[model samples]
Target chain A: MPGVLVIAEVADGKVLPVAFELLGAARALSAEGAGPVSALVPGQAHAQELIARGADVVYVAPESLAGQMYDAWLPAVDAALQQSGADIVLLGQTASLGRDLGPALAFAHRTAIAPEVTALKLENGRLRVTRPCYGGNARAEHTFAGQLQIASAKPKTFDALEPDASRTGEVKTIDAVGQSRITVLSVEKVESEGVRLEDADVVVAGGRGLGDPSAFAMLEELAKLLRGAVGASRAACDLGWYPPSSQVGLTGKTVSPTLYIAVAISGASQHMAGMSGSKNIVAINKDPEANMVKAAKYAVIDDYRKVLPAFIEEVRKLKAQG
Target chain B: MNIIVCVKQIPDPETPASSFRVDEAAKKVVPAQGIPPVVNPYDPQATEAALRLKEAAGGGKVTVISLGPESARDAIKHALAMGADEGILLNDPGFEGIDNFQTAVALAKAIEKVGQYDLILMGRAAADWDMGVVPMGVATLLGIPCVSIAKAIERVDGKVRVTRVLDDGFQTVEAPLPAVVSVSNEFGEPRYPQLRQIMLAAKKTVQVWNAADLGLSADQLGEANRWLKLEALYVPKVESKVEIIEADSPEEKARILAQKLRADKLI
Candidate 1:
């Protein structure tokens, strides 16, 4: 039986939470008679956790493969796929890694890949995937014609199953092959200030309505107080009001936080595509008819400049009382 | 250093949500009436990257290419108006409804027919499909290394040095020349075309090519050869019921919102 193969991604010596999420997603598809689910990781550090999450078999690439470029990592994953004989492959959508690796692998394998997929299922022996299109204004369902099916799931789209301590699975190591043609002469990591935007439970995103670039400082204060991360719409990022790393939109990063607070964002379809999946949305814009307000769960129809400070103060007091 | 920047024409992303519609039967978006199509927002940034590279190289050509309907010429013209040296339009009935893989195949063929080029550039992703797969696919077909989601790119010591955007921060990577790079919106705002440049661009002829021109057969292009089939396309039902927090003043509104969030256990 052709099983489902998952690429368990590791960052900074720890398995990313999204890896478990991918396993959860793969597990669901495998439940429909797809077959046992297997996982491959570039390093040994996260093999056991993957087994606990639902991987029936775990393949560990050589430790030397860790932190290697996609060119180096591709052959190992390709080998695992061949060895496992898995027809379906799932990967978590990472900013730099999976975005490049998925397409390259699909191209190499002569298969199709659905990137930033939000939903998937096995129907009549075919993998049906759903992803946003037209900047999230609509969703497109796609099915592959090739022998192998691959997709990258957006983070936070599915819940990671609680680890079963009693669960046991076979774990084996595999050799890494291939060399990256690109050279990394230097890697300069920009130090970020607060919680990472993708990992945050709550995100306070600002937009062009902030009036000026410095207005983002107010958003940072509110986000810091709430112990959340600050995000920006494409408009704000395009205006140079904030770093592109903080941008949340179609062309930027897709975020699905527990709570999303939009300050002066007009909620363009492009921006909505990224955060519409948030569990709860709050829009603070003077225009009552703004798309953000229409899509939000709650609305404050007033100038964000006037309301933000008050909202920040109230949240502080609430936390203080606690 | 010759650069080939791929551009695409897409419906204006800012089209109002209510006006946006999809033809379920055709599995495509219905262009909003009266809202003329605009260049995919990111494509301009890609063209900007190409033009800047050409300038920095002291003398090079930036050719903008598009694979779409004849109206897509507007996108190529927009690039030329923005200071690109030339334009190419891969327009053919056979090219219609091709998926990203086939699109990449066609584009790679076009690049080969165009002959020598030191670099290829494209937007991080088209606003329409948002797939972001084409650049890598083209790179793979052309046998070149690809670096994507680049916020900044510069030709350093004859190598393409790119600052790539990651979820957490940024990382700098360098690839050899004749590489493919996809520029992100974060690269900075693209320049606006002046009236004089637009007039000059109107006079410049855009080279038109077809599947035959690229040495591709009908069986090798379009929807039939696409690897992925579009099962359906539709607007998701958004049933959000927004509760307007009305109060006498901003402070009162904040208090009510806070209380409501507490009640809902959102904060």
Candidate 2:
């Protein structure tokens, strides 16, 4: 029986955390009578960690597939699919590579891809997946109808297995090198300081209610005090009050931190979907009935400008007392 | 140069969650009262990308294509108002309840019928289905390369250069002409048409073509031809339970909320 293959995504030579989460999901499928779980690293990577986290086999491809460029990654993934003959393949649902490569690969195979699936199961030798749709207002369960099953799993939807050094797996180097017709002129990486939004335990997010770009300074201060990262809503990002890299919504980064503080956000369905998995939520909004306030476990129905400063000060005092 | 931009009309994504409803049995959204459908938010960004490329080329024809219901004409008209030179609507009863693959088939057919194009532009994803696969599907069928999530698109020596958004950063890549590009919101706001342009767009004849005109049969278009099966669609029930912090002043309210967090061991 063909099991699952994880197309582990890489950035700056580091295996993204989503790779391990996908292995966890793949292992679950294997445990349920699907065959062994194999991982495909499209670049140079250590197989020990992936193997420790449930991958039975790891195929490391050439470094050309390291970046998110579709043309660079597609041939390697295609070759892996054919060589491994895996029935189901998974990729991290990153906006850049996964979104671009998954569909193109599926189309190349004369099939289609299931995008941003939250949950998936192995049912009667087929793959059944649930994905959010309609701007996250609804979820649609889907099944691949006798086609090669391919999906981009949403980040944070699955937990990475606890790594165990005792586990052992085969690491094979594959020569399925990728060559792209597109010319890469230049590459520019955004200079980011502190924890990335995805890795942050606490996320202090602001919205259009901040009213001015300068307000992000205070939000950043609070994020710094909490040793967390700061994010923003689509509206605030579009308004140029914050960088688009920090936007938190369906169209932007999907963040699921331990604590998500939504400041002055209205909590549009799209925004909530991105942060819905947050373990706990707090809202500071003047509107009592705002969606953000309603969804929050703790809410202060007052102007964020009025609440944020004092909230920051109180948090500071409490931390100092400790 | 000639460019094609695909647009879609969807129920307004800005509708508050409180008013959004779904019929689990029928698997459809209950149209919120008095809210009209609008073009998918990202479609305008794609349109902006197309318009910018056309303008940069010194001269080019930008045609907007939409595969949707009769209301989809509004989406086509939207692109026209935003400096598109022509509009085409791929409308047919057979087009209803089709998947993205079928949608891509029809759009690719329409592009073939148009007979001339250097680039195809589309939003990264539609707000309704939000699958964002049609562009790639079309590009694949056409045997052209596709670059998605473009923040900037330029005509570099007759080749299309796109600055694409990646998971962590950005990369600038160049593809041959007639390639497909899907624009993201980072491309910046689209140009809002002036009154005169809107009036002119209203009068332009939007050529309507059905599935047959695209040489597609009814059997090739709808539910039976779908690649993926929809098992169930439902509005997930989300219970909102909030503990409101009440106090005489903002400072007091802040202090109380902090105390509550400490008690919960969250702070």
Q: Candidate 2 on A1-322: residue-level lDDT in tens?
A: 5878898877777788888999999998898877889898865456887899998888888866776467677777777777777889898878657877888888888776899888889888788999999888889988875568988877887889999999999887888666676777888888668989988899999999878889999999989998899999989987889988898878888888888999999888888878988999999988898888888999998877888889999999999999
What lDDT tens digits, residue by residue, belong to model 1 across residues A241-292?
9987788987677788989999999998889878888999999999998989
How accurate locally is residue A4 in candidate 2, as Cα lDDT from 0 to 100? 88
Q: Identify the candidate with maximal TM-score.
A: 2
Residue pairs in candidate 2 whose N, alpha carbon or C atoms collide under 3 angstroms: none
Model 1, A117: alpha-carbon shift in Å?
0.9
lDDT at A242 for candidate 1?
94
Displacement of residue B110 (Cα, Å) in model 2 is 1.7
lDDT string, candidate 2, B48-122, tens digits: 888887787888899999998999999999889888999999998888777898888889999999989999999
Residues B73-114 of candidate 1 have per-residue lDDT tens digits of 999999999999899999999888989888998899999988
